[model samples]
Target: MQTLHYLTLSVLIPPLLSFFAEPGALFFEGGATNVGMIMDWREMAGRPTVRGMQGEDRWNAYYGAWSGGKQLGSGWVEGMWDGRTDPMRGWVIAFSWMFASFADIYYLCILVRRPRLLLDFALTLGFSHIVLTTYYSASIPTSLFFWIVMFTWSATTVTIAEQICVKREMTEGLVISPPRDEVDDLEMGELLRRD
Candidate 1:
């Protein structure tokens, strides 16, 4: 049950936060009125069919270089950037991920109150992303950049969470006083010793 809870939160939270961070790209058409960038769900999920195109045609349309002019079929179009093909959207997504990682520290350290499991939770989140991307894309992500980003995010989360948790644990109050009877007995012994 505990494992289930951890897995659920670790796997679900970051992506959900990312989506929320940039909802216009996912929900609004073309991300903006003039952008000509549409969220290609089929391409994102690695399905072969997209707007009556299939196989190589679908792949080319979605992943091919931008040629400009009214070509809504291609994922990369003029004035618009998908994270894969351009740096603008890539940076936006990176920021979103950073925000999510910060939230993870609060969730794991303060809310869940399990500082020791911070590393495990951070690793679980990274591994979950890999598994999810593979499942959705129907193939393992072969990009070196993707792996590097995942590692960086996980390492950062763990580092920050560990520091916060350690600080919290260190400042926690300690109970040094004995029970009432023990204190009375010690007092009486001290009195006798003094006599």
Candidate 2:
């Protein structure tokens, strides 16, 4: 649920804003002005904020670039940073997606899984994807794919949490304890003994 809240609030907003904001691009070329706790304001120009639709950076990326580092467009993960500060936000976003994937798997491993928390995590993921989508419009298909995956994970987690909650309530209802009876008699007995 917390993750869902963040998904609805934090993670989702940036990308939605990026999509509409028109200026905040995701690729290296989409130079930006970031505002956050860790970030103040920056000016990144002539950098590859957005992946250009040309050259081997697109086609020969998978095969040729494996020797040193993965392509910069490798979703900013899988070896995409170039020792620049762009990773401040993109790297965190990429890492978040990675963390969310791990969490989704972890919840699946829970013995008595209540995956509602996964929804929040998935929401975080959705927003991360939204960030990617906002910047790399060309990468829409990939971002959209991940969004679908997040939704699937969310559905599973939410169902699990709901089940757990219902089961917990039922279990609490069935708890056995001494019944409440003869309260007035007990009170009268106590009062007479005190006198």
Candidate 3:
């Protein structure tokens, strides 16, 4: 049950955050002919062309943004920083994924409250990323940059969560004392013996 909860959150939260952050990536653009229809809900709901892909082609490009895949372009470093191309959008998306990772880790720490389990949680998140990317793209993601980003996300999350949990544990002291009844009985016995 705990594993199910961890895996579900590990797979779901980051992508949900990405969707909220970059909703424009999910819509089909009609170019100059439909300049006024840019934010059409109908387009977003149906099989919208993502990054110039349509219908079945979109499946090959459905890499999750949380996994370092961009809807507008290739999420790989080579695609983002190609020698004559502007890389601003790619960098922004990457940072957003990192930010989402922070939130995900923080929430997990609060819920699980076990520092030792953080590594396992982080691994689950990384595995989910690989599975999602592979499933969506229909091929193994061989991009070095993608794997690096995924590793960075997992490492950073575990490190920060551990730090936070350790600090919290240190600050929260446990109080251990004898029962009130035992204390009273000892006090009465001492009084009787003295008299």
Candidate 4:
């Protein structure tokens, strides 16, 4: 369950955030740099350092900072401090949806116990992704359909897990073990335990 939650957030959150917030804003406005920060630290280290806004600055920050610049004709080290390229909205949506779908399928395989149930859920999930990929529509009805499938899958997994747990509990105390000592065959065919 926790795995499901984490996978959901990781696969959904970043692109959703990018929709509203500028990618640059997602990072510090005045970028900070330090041994740790330059080392890709997300938080302040022992010492605090501040970096100016990332863009086509004298330091040529944009080249490394913006995929826009990287994807365009800008050289690997050149900075595009002045402007941004196309957001590639369609590609972003497509990739995000596909990635989330893949993650869900992988996690479902791990969570579901019964092979038949797993196959059913997996087929449903694959179809849902196909609908999404084919339409690329965010209409309310489409969104609702996606959520419904997701919820149903979650419910089924929980129910199956509970059933398994209950079964294990019911049989736990009734488990039988073989005799610890060796057993020998008697003349009449009955087995006798040897001390």
Best by lDDT: 1
Q: In candidate 4, what are the lDDT values of residues 1-195, reduced to their tens digit?
A: 344633563556455545743445334222221112112112111111223245556544433232223332232434432333223322333344344555555565557644446556655654554454334322223334334444564555445544554555567658675554433324224533433
The lDDT of each candidate is 0.52, 0.41, 0.51, 0.40
Model 3, 50-149: lDDT tens digits are 3323563533544323212433334334434111211232343355447657776767678767889888877876687567546654556565555566
Q: For this target, which candidate reaches the highest TM-score against the unseen true structure?
A: 1
What C-alpha lDDT does candidate 3 achieve relative to the native structure? 0.51
Model 1 spans with C-alpha error above 4 angstroms:
1-71, 74-84, 175-195
- Looking at model 4, the pairs that clash are 31-51, 56-81
What's the true lDDT of residue 168 in model 2? 62
Show the colliding residue pairs in model 3: none
TM-score of every candidate: 0.52, 0.32, 0.48, 0.27
Candidate 2 Cα deviation (angstroms), residue 103 = 5.4
Q: How many times do residue backbones clash in model 3?
A: 0
lDDT for position 43 in model 1: 28
For residues 112-156, what per-residue lDDT tens digits would candidate 2 score against the true structure?
244345455445655664564445443333334344445654565
Name the lDDT value of residue 179 in candidate 1: 95
Q: Please report how far candidate 3 places residue 41 from its true position, in Å.
A: 25
Model 2 alpha-carbon drift over 4 Å, by segment: 1-63, 66-125, 133-138, 142-148, 162-178, 182-185
Query: Could you tell me the TM-score of candidate 2?
Result: 0.32
Ordering by TM-score: 1, 3, 2, 4
